[model samples]
Target: MKNLLLTFCLIISLTATAQRYSDQAYLQDRAEKFDLNEETQNIALLQIASDRNKAIKILSENGLLHPYEKKIRKDFEYRPLTDMHIVALSRYQEQFIYLTDKAVLSNAWAGKFYIDHGIQNPKGMAIGADFLTLVAGNSELRVFQNGQKIWNTSVNNLNPIALEYDKTTGHFLILTEDALYQLDLTLKTMEKVYDGSNLTAMCYYNDEIVLGTKDGIQSLNRKTFALNKSNQKLPWTEITSLKNIRGALWFGSTKGAFKLRSDGKYDYYASKRWLVDDHVVDLEKGPDDTVLVLTKEGMSKINFEPMTLAQKADYFQEIQRSRHIRYGFTTDLTLQTPGDLSTGYNHDTDNDGLWTSMYLAGELFRYAVTKSEDAKLNAYEAFEAMERLTSLPDLKGFPARSFERDGYEIGLHANGFSGEWYKKHVEENGRIWRLSDDEIWRWKSTTSSDESCGHFFVYALFAELAPDKAWRDRAIHQIKIEMDHIMDNNWYLVDWNGEPTAWGKWNPKYVNSFPTNVGDRRLNSTLILSFLQTAYHFTTDEKYKKAAEKLIRKYGYDENANRPATTIGFVEGEDLSDKWNHSDDEMYFLTMPGFVNYSFSEEQKTAHFNTVKSHWEVERSEKNPLWNYLFALSGSKNIDSEESAWWLREFPMDLIDWKVDNSHRKDLTKIEPNFRSQTYSEVLPGDERTLHLHNGAYRNNGGSDGNREYAPYIYLLPYWAGRYVDAISAPVPN
Candidate 1:
């Protein structure tokens, strides 16, 4: 009766508010209503208190809701902006002006404004003690009182490149590489202060004039034009810019940037961690408790505010709500070409069964923890999507990668899928995308074994956590169907093409074919044993237990599970060792539930625990919160929960697929490529330009020629799962 009323209300609402709109039209409603991009709108939605129906209703009325279609309700909220990536940052009065080669006026209390003023007309800025702004152009010096220019003088007449104004002497110091000149406010009287070969940058600190030269940093006495005794330590000779924050001295250089504390300790922030690029061009302390770092390529903002874990959870909750919602179900979203949230989701996303199952598992954890009605409904919705997948193409247990509205196909080129994949395909949608078929729907026929692992892993979670006896029984029954299909087909997912799908092989023949030196043979053995254990626990099926025992006794699957990946390196030119696969890492650890909770014997439990621990230890340096959360389950004393919280806190506020080029960066320490590595990072996971699926993430040093956004399950699974397992403490609501 309640659902009927809600459905009736939805019908009424759609009748009243609906109109004929194109997919592009779906992309642009919120900006017209509340004036923010989708990501920013999502962040604002998350900031509202969870139970604040009034605020939620207001956002709904204002058309600030995400997906542009989700109804405004107390539980329907999420966030997108977790980053403050920028081009340049400056301050005028209380305003934080961002400069992406243009003036972008930013305010916490007001909407931002932008103009292309002096976009190229800048070389130096001289700020007076009165807080007036003076911009040095190639041929002129323009002075501004507030944000408005007051006066201009001809710098071509002065023949100076660098400019600085002195507060104590009430004079201006104009500089070129060859000479430094002292001039009055009128620029009429000029006295040469210092003779130098090259002057790079300058700033006022400690009530003295500090000039950055090719030689080193030197302080000059303005009173007599004499050099002061300057014996301060520096990391590099060529300084770009300097700022004194409170009392600690901070400076940028050709090498990197660092700070000298009062207690004589040096704090460092190099690589992509704190720098957009390592050619540090300038530094400015901006309003709103932000320190600005500008480079030749881009700008970054460092907020002084501490983010609590509850806030972090709130952030990811909304991120999952907004970007990762997936038709209120789940699928691998097309991140290569981002969805505008206007036309909604792309019709051609792959791995629906796998991705949706993981999301469903995460929702299971969420429901178990909060018992929120929303979580239950969401879990049910996803289960409906996933459980129906096995039936989508008239197959009993073979799960397709995805199904799409008839005309959509993935990876289409001028000729179609390209190479052998192109079997008479052509480009559509303005030659940008490939298209095929003419019917109601088309499902990807070729599936992989990874999908199988994902499916069973999530199924186990659902069967264990489903709220009611009916839901539990349903989950168990479905698991039985898939498990039986695999067993009947001799341990493989037979695709629609009547061939074994790639990566779906699990017979002893295939599992044992992999060389023991590589990770796959051991990995497949571990996973199949886990699957058998999961099936047996739910159905009390003796066949499942016998199968697992056969693998252990005959194929040494138990010994296989105890093998650490580090102990046996991937050999070159073999089946493995091409590269370290983070996806494989995901699959291996995701299979851990059978080891921990499926009531395994002490021997099997110890073996699986060792496998989980070895993998987790090798991955500790990555500091991925999800990995850490899963690692804690092994009951290893080496768990690093503190880093887990830090990982959540460091998630970027901006979730857009902005170009993050790390090429030509100066601060990175490069390591030699090996089978154990994709790309080495001098910084932690939080410090990278973007987070992406581990498969292709390590190909380039930092960025790809193109980009894609990712699912928040990348965040949510680890966060909520961590909370459930007590690896991390749940935060109190602020």
Candidate 2:
């Protein structure tokens, strides 16, 4: 008798725990009526009594509701339960939906409206008439109403890889690797739909279910289950990923990415030449229609905008204006100023210098938009500046080596002064110099023979943009000289002279010595391509084309070959020789050989167009947003692919943490004992960190005071990618 009593007690406790609410307590006290099905009536009665225990436990566990002590109250009398009542109760129980109005009649379930949250992992989610379902890694089918998971069920052998909804039958179709299953909620069972293929992803469109796999993409009628391969020519060797954005379907593979069109065709992007390291992990469309691509190496955002004829005409006028400035015309001082006479026509912080090279680039853009003579003349002036700058000294002597100026000595110690002085010295005289203190403690200048590629791009731009015979001849002459000065027997630019001078012995600047050489392949390719492109623009010279092709082939023209898959010898600020000292360096360098093949191709346009796309991806991830913008400017036909627009909209410059540290160095309190006997003090202050953006260019985290300002030119990115319009369009803040 005692054992029986204990069993009864245990049964009662279990029953109490299972109960969802108190039995119709509120209904008995209220005048309003509620009619529900037998099961829902029981649930409604329990819910009225405010059974906190059961509802709280279920909602919290399902990630539906936060735990709160607030009680829910509704005044309604009880009525007969029905099917609609059961469905209504189920829908109300979901966390995503909220009750705005009570059911008007007993047993009615159609009074509430539901809003949906944006889809998460939508590529694999199964859609149904009233619900969406997804299987987690644990093989549980979690049913969601309005983006809130209502319930879940555990099923074995159902490794669902893709999902689609059959609106006609209100059934959810699940695509597994081996078979397909159709789930019927009313029957509480799953039926075999179809079988026989390695399915990867699925989507529902226009009463058809689309399934993508390794073979190809196929469509099936939702009700009939009739399968038909899509007419589109999808190059899917291994369809590893898929996404649907704004009614468009995107497919990804080892080769590249493609978008499905309305007429059942595929448009390929970032294949062959244009994707940087093509192991795509994710693809998304932003709110502004920008395409965001995340890859194994980095992320890329693309914006495409179409160029209009009116815009082209405007660009031509700008090109004509630039030509006037280059040819020594007195223009508005605000926009174009002659080179400073005192500084020998060097570009300075005062914005008085013509910056002929920059203007040349602008001219090229005009020529590209509308082939004009003025643009060609401006381009020639740019080449002239390059020729003159090349004759300047490669190194200026301070306590340490610095950029040269004045053809004699280093410039005075001033912030943002060295680069300007160097520019002035090179522009005026055909000799590199350093400004220094003489025996009398007065400033003196000296000259040197070392050379650099500081202004080489000017010649390259002119070679491409120049239309007149004089401009073309001058550009060719300058190119040959610059090439002879920099290129070694191996075709790589030797960093410095090999002879000793009065100031110091000649030292070869290793690849790591200057930030500019970190990606030497890109620099060389840009220069070679510039020449080839210019030749193509002019006399259609096959020799130039062949030369460019040879260089690109030797380097590796494609995106994959240009990037190092592994993180070896890739340390920032380390000399190139030291970084690539290990065996892996050879492999990393080997990847760049695709450039050669791309450059040599005789086709007017080949897969090499993809190279721009690839570099944009790489640059985006490299913390250089400008390059991405530049790539879009040149490669994209429309602004739809630009990430810059989104950045401007969502993330403002004020949110960025910009810091600068300027502190004196204590370690340099005393000069070296050996050099103490020298006439001038050699002590230099500690490096300062600051942010400076001038002339539509920016530098972040600039190191040491002397070297605090760094332009993004080292990457050969947007500024040097030959997108003249985009380069000039960069907004300069007041």
Candidate 3:
């Protein structure tokens, strides 16, 4: 009866606290509620429209506007598009025609469903000069008029595998393995155009037969029957299909895909960012600057137009609301839905506590400045998720890495997991956790120190700025529990297996073991100082201060805390030298803000302030808006407000992880030694770099792994932080 009553009450409590979010609905409502000049809605919208028009006019006053449409990601809609071995694609006026395997599908406006008119064993197809559809088979050629076969015949002993129509002379051309044939439809005569055995694909351009063959790309003259080779060479071995999209040639081959450059060389588009699969079976350009490619996986649309910054930010926001934000914290994802893109796209995270804490920090700042109730709800939602992490262990204050289903995870399914990992699960309370029989969940054991640092980092912000008294009290309560747990356990986060998780150790044996110049020593020392500062600031507890003083006065940790800002760049033989640790840089900066802001006195504040300033002095060249604004907030001298704003403005509006390489470019500026030892072309990080994690700031050339899309938090954190701190005004929505 006791357990049942407790369970009954717990259900009611959890039910009462759970709040579902409707982001778009809530934001739309909030925008209405916060809409400026609500009494004159038309007048306000008119003014905004005029302002937008003026901005556009000024942008285009001296230059002609090249109209384009940018593609918003619709990850799910393409699912129904299906993986087809697309052999040919062409646009006949308004109709979209494509063939895969032996089937042909015709649609209008690239619609999801085909028009249901199809052909069997379609080896190749094209629209003839007479506007009739011509399809070539293994040994036959057929002409169709308005979905009905008007003509079908066996070509006289010529194995026609591909077809092309010539508008210049009203003729049809055929491609076989070793020869090209030109058929005069008016005269009913066939002429051998080019003699080549390894011919792959052919198209007529400017009255010349442009051919993609095994050796190279060459043109055949009809009258002379002479082959003139271009300087271009095939990047791939076997060119499967050739397409004349808007007069430019696009080629698909076994190795990758290509578009012929004006200089006659081929530009390869093999990277996943460009193609869903590198072994592209087919490609076509559709309306609105859309490049559609087909592979073994499915068809994908590529947007040639780039977005404005505002659009990129909007894209980021939509992705966060729709895809990346899970349980109110930002994390990576493996799969997502398409169509309206209104799915959760939820996935588990190993660093749930850590990642959530950073996102929580962003929302806290956002709500502090904008006073948006939605932002507050978002923050608290994450806060609730985080609170569950700490309390699940029932080990006073030990935080878990994550929680998962009881047996769904096959191995080590202990602690909400099963399978091999179950062996390491330290049974506390009960093995089945009578919370439920089958629904029994487990919190992950052996959480990392970075996760611990992250929790303290956000709790400091929340303790002071939670929108409601309940949230504020919860923040303070969680802070004390976590701090006490660490202090009681002699400053280590004890894991489920009864040992400190690999990175959570901060004892003297761990701290003093590293030489003074070591990065970890400074990093760990800064982390502890910040953690202690945060705990004391929230609880006004003296023990936290005393613990901090002993580390500083006894072990020279304060000196170590000041080491990173001075020691990070261009130096050799210093402990943990040369390799840029962006993650550590992230932690160092993440912690310092709290440590300096909540320092017990002015003297301590000044010293910490200087450390941040020195650090900023070195980091200024990176042109990251987040770091600049953070430095400005930290009281750094000579911090350029315009530079910070420039960083935000220059942030590439496209957040998709397209593998970008500027190393081969003839236009790049000279590379110089920045602090990171990474060669930077004169361009700023925000302007030219790929969409990367915060740690990827210094790397100029690299491909993104996975689907490589990003949550807008990186942009949002800095954009809003600048707005909050008055570093940069938000650009008006266009």
Instruction: List TM-scores for all candidates, in order.
Output: 0.68, 0.33, 0.58
lDDT-wise, the better of 2 and 3 is: 3
Q: Which structure among the candidates has the greatest lDDT?
A: 3
Residue lDDT tens for model 1, 1-734: 01212322332333223221111101000001112333433332211111112121122212223222322222233221113222333444434333233333343225433333362445445556554555554566555554666665664544455666776777777777667877565654656778766676666677666777765677877576678855335545577766765555667776556666565544444444455445555555533544555444434445555455555556666766775655455533344443233333443455667677777777887787788787788788887766765666666766666655556555533212456444432221122221223356556655666777777887777776777868877777777887887887888888654667657888888877767767787788777887888788878889988877877898788777678878657676775656676777778777765654453586666767777777777777766666665555444434566666656665554443434443433334457776766444544334344445533334333533223445666666776766655555555433
Q: What is the lDDT of residue 434 in candidate 1?
A: 15
Return the candidate ranking by lDDT, descending: 3, 1, 2
Clashes of 3: 20
lDDT minimum window of 10 residues, candidate 3: 25-34
Clashes of 2: 66
Q: Give the Cα error of residue 185 in candidate 1, in Å.
A: 12
Give the winner by TM-score.
1
Model 2 vs. true fold: TM: 0.33
For 645-730, candidate 3 gives per-residue lDDT tens digits of 55665565445565655454322354666556567454433534455766666666675553445566878776666555555444
